[model samples]
Target: MTDWLSASAMLLAGVIVGAMFLYGMRRRQDRSDLERADLEAKRDALIARLREAPDPSLERDAAEVLRKLDKMGVEAAPLGGAAGGLKPAATQIKGFLWGAGSVAAIAAIVFFVTRQTKPAAPADPLADLERSVQQNPDNLPLRDDLAKAYLDRNNIEGVSEQTQYVLQRNPSDARALTYSAIVHIIARQPEAAAAMLQRATQSDPNLVDAWVGVAWLNAQAGDMPRAEAAMAEAKRRHPEMAERLDQLMAHLRGPSKAEAVHVTLNYGGQARGMIFIIARAAGVTSGPPAAVKRLPLSTFPIDVDLSAADSMMGQPLPQKMRIEARIDSDGDPLTHDPKDPGAVAEGVVLGNSVSLTLK
Candidate 1:
């Protein structure tokens, strides 16, 4: 942007300089013509004086007029001077060059200064969004958008981070679990893949994809009975989704593929208390009202270990999976704040939500 402004300033300066130089040249020519006319008038006055009064005083007066013409820088012949008007001509030439040079220098300085003062161009919105996500990875809405951005760019690293973020919220998140399982399976980690598949099933038994996951894991292990059983269960639960599930299973069993894998949510990393991981769909738009299940972290300072790579499967995290940690205070939790809402930090990222007291 700065470069563009500089170029534009240069073009404008060139145009302005050209115009001023042309005008200056014309003005100098006009001034020269006026001087010539004045010199001619003085000469005619002297000739008339000599014709009318042939006096010595008149001759001396005409000599003074000629001297005044020389001071006025009129480049004309003196009445009988040996050297013509060389001195006045040199003065006019020097003055014009000095004036033109000064104008050019001033124009150049103005152009550069204007260019320097111009504002810079705007930043990329997507790049800004990515940076925001990196700084605050636990922001689910931002993370979701970032995940799609990574998908568009085919950036596996970004995809992994975003998927891990979703899992951090709700370890049992079906989409996250499914993607994580796919990633692990492609990396030849059948045990890890099976674990995630089991997590998805526990979160939502109706999710046929989870059963497919189990089937794929079992098939890779040469356990056809468990594999077939898992497939049958998937068919029974999701009759409509059976065909697609089979296609997916077939693809997973194909030739080996490289994958960028990451660990599941780590529940033991909970700082304050037992942290919960919630996983929502990759692009979930809206959720239910503020119940214990869908409570925003602002109202409740839950110490959810959001960045945990593994999730506890003994119980379901949450149906919607927004809150991660419940910082179990020693006593009964506070209900309301007396001061300003802005003074009390509400729903920020989980990292900022850690505290034993409301403050």
Candidate 2:
């Protein structure tokens, strides 16, 4: 009876031990599942954050989270075969991303260094002139030089500013007045130019160029008597120009003709230096001109009669001719370089003031 009691108690104790072992195993499994789910949720959250990350700071944080996930994956190696296999792949992906980040950092450094080593562009000549002018505003010679430079470049606004400044300092300045007259001529205001030229001569009577310009304008206006008087004055002021004055006189007294070609010159745009006007028979590209006149660019919008006296030879003038006006950059009447800007009027008739544009 005592042996039977012992066996029954041993069986009861075995049953209780077996039941406790099963419950502990189930509890451990539930904890493992909870840990895996938590790790997966953390990885998903890190991936989402990485997708919206704007800068390197968030990228680093995401990388760190990936490393932790990778470590957790290794720690949960016994959970399943799939979990164990994910460890190496996750480590490789992390290494690739780190390499890419390092490369990007290196590229940024190279780009910045290259930019720092590049050379700057050269300074502009006009800018240098402007700076010098600003530094010495009262220098009249410098101002005039700057004004001339502006005129050469056809910069009307710049020319006006510099010339106006010089004029303000000395209103009776002959040179400034002449330059202003030139500007007026370029602007196609002949009356204003003539006034300025007149003022320039009045301020200084001995100004030979001014006197010559006056004579030329008068001749253009068909006031031959006034032109001759102005020419005499120019010769008196500078006797060395007597021969030139004689040649101009001869041109003014052109050979008599039943009908002479009349030309009215008009400037379509900006013009400077000298102008060479020629009348050639239509289709005659070479040989001496039928009539020719060389005048300063300032004498534009002027009417001139072309007759046999303007002819290079003593022969009669052609009936049918084309008139050409060339802006001579070098002031050489003998040259008609194709590069020089010019204009031509075809089918021109004698005894008629045919208007033409010097482009």
Candidate 3:
């Protein structure tokens, strides 16, 4: 679209320039014609004066005027000769050359503009898959392949539409359900994602990806126990993935330590709420947190352990840290809602339990 607009502007500019050039040329030609006619009239008047009075002074004046008219290329009255025909022929040749040059310039401008305005070919791999799916409407495998392609491209809308179509045909399709859950995760609706993943797992107990998805979502949502349980189930279903699962678990749980902090929380009469325990490097308040843990308000005065597994990815837990316990009613561990009541205790060292009261 941009290219087309540019080409159109260029074409319009060319037309305006051409019109101005032609107008200037025509005006110049008209001026030249008027100058020639004026010179001829002056020469004819001088000749008539010379013929009427044969005085020496008048003849000299007429001679001077004739010389000036010759110098200016102004022809006298028609002698019915070849010179008059040749003058028009020369003018015609000049006009033709100018017209031809102008045409050539316009052609070059058009050619360059067209080349620049041409759109490049699109590079979409899903085009073929979509066409195939369209042709084979009843082909479940083809539809699933199209949905996977959409997922790979991160086209959440396309993925949802395709997966929903597949689910309508087969609600128990584990792969489709998992794909839908992934879309929800991308949209930051972890609860919706967990529900879909749970359904997928129920449909197929051996779906390792579904279990892993559930575990990751649970961990992100601050439900560590459920995350660990899902990871265990995933590992149990496929022991070959134990090493990978162990790495994931370590990342989620953080590093182990001989001593840990046991946080005692007083929720101030709030019976059912979510508590997030985060440990950050002392005095560092504006970056990736050191480690995080999610707990229930009902479980007050619980033993809390801050380890490397609880640490965020790529950020290790600091030896000296500040611990904070937030009582969040929304159940989101990462976000701090102003309306939710929480508590903070800063500058606390590791390997020691800290008690915090939530008002």
lDDT leader: 3
Error in Å for residue 342 of model 3: 5.0
RMSD of 3: 9.8
**Residue 136 deviation, candidate 2, in Å?**
3.9
What TM-score, computed on C-alpha atoms, does each candidate reach?
0.35, 0.35, 0.42
lDDT of 3 by residue, 86-145 (tens): 674456556656655666577567768778787889967689889889999888778878
- lDDT over C-alpha atoms for residue 252 of model 2: 56
Provide the lDDT at 15 for model 2. Answer: 51
Winner by lDDT between candidate 2 and candidate 1: 2
lDDT of each: 0.52, 0.67, 0.70
Per-residue C-alpha lDDT of model 2 across residues 35-153, encoded as one tens digit per residue? 66676666567667778766677667656755665665544233453646555445545554555455545555655665678677898777777888999999876777777677656
Q: Model 3: residues >4 Å from true position, as ranges? A: 1-171, 176-208, 214-250, 253-264, 268-299, 303-356
Local error of candidate 2 at 344, Å? 7.1
- Roughly what TM-score does model 3 have, to 2 decimal places? 0.42
List, residue by residue over 276-309, the lDDT tens digit for candidate 1: 2223322332332121211222324333332211
Give the backbone clash total of model 3: 10
Q: After superposing candidate 2 on the true structure, give the runs of residues whose Cα lies further than 4 Å from its correct spot.
A: 1-135, 145-161, 186-188, 245-359
